[model samples]
Target: MSTANERARMTDLALQEWGVVVGILAERGESWPDTDVTRWGPGVTAAMERTRALCAACSIVGATEAADIGRLADLYEARTRS
Candidate 1:
């Protein structure tokens, strides 16, 4: 039920957080741990699902782009978390 602007802000925040995590992972040259699947997986999955729904409802191309950015963030979160 978020407005477009709110969704955009959320997407930006997610991307920023993901970028930091990815940078750390790259520097470590190590994959993330998989044992804690229950912790990160559900959150990432929910984020992606929300992002996809937001993309579908987006009225502006920019909003769609923001959603795409959010998707990338979710991808990074999933990859780095496991």
Candidate 2:
């Protein structure tokens, strides 16, 4: 069995991986454009919300590893955001 700290590290990896995936999905969501499918669509928005939840959960991990992922993601996101 893994030690407590090792398990915690695994959890942090999971959270941060989810965070990066969430960021990717969020980036893809931006390309949908202002079409009827984007504006009048419930499914697309629901998916976006679900994807965002991964990132939200990452914040709750509160681990240094997860935080590092968030920081890296933020820097990557900044390039895209600009």
| Best by the TM-score measure | 1
Enumerate residue pairs that collide in model 2: none
Steric overlap count per candidate:
0, 0
Model 2, TM vs. native = 0.36
TM-scores for candidates 1 onward, in order = 0.40, 0.36
- Compose the digit string of candidate 2's lDDT tens values, residues 1-82: 4455754665455444545455444555643223344353555555545534544544465433333444535544554578
lDDT of each: 0.51, 0.47
Tens digit per residue, CA lDDT, model 1, 18-60: 4654455445463344223344444454654554454554424
- Point out where model 2 deviates above 4 Å: 30-82
Candidates' RMSD to native: 8.3, 7.5
Candidate 2 at residue 19, lDDT? 51
lDDT of 1: 0.51
In lDDT terms, which candidate is top? 1
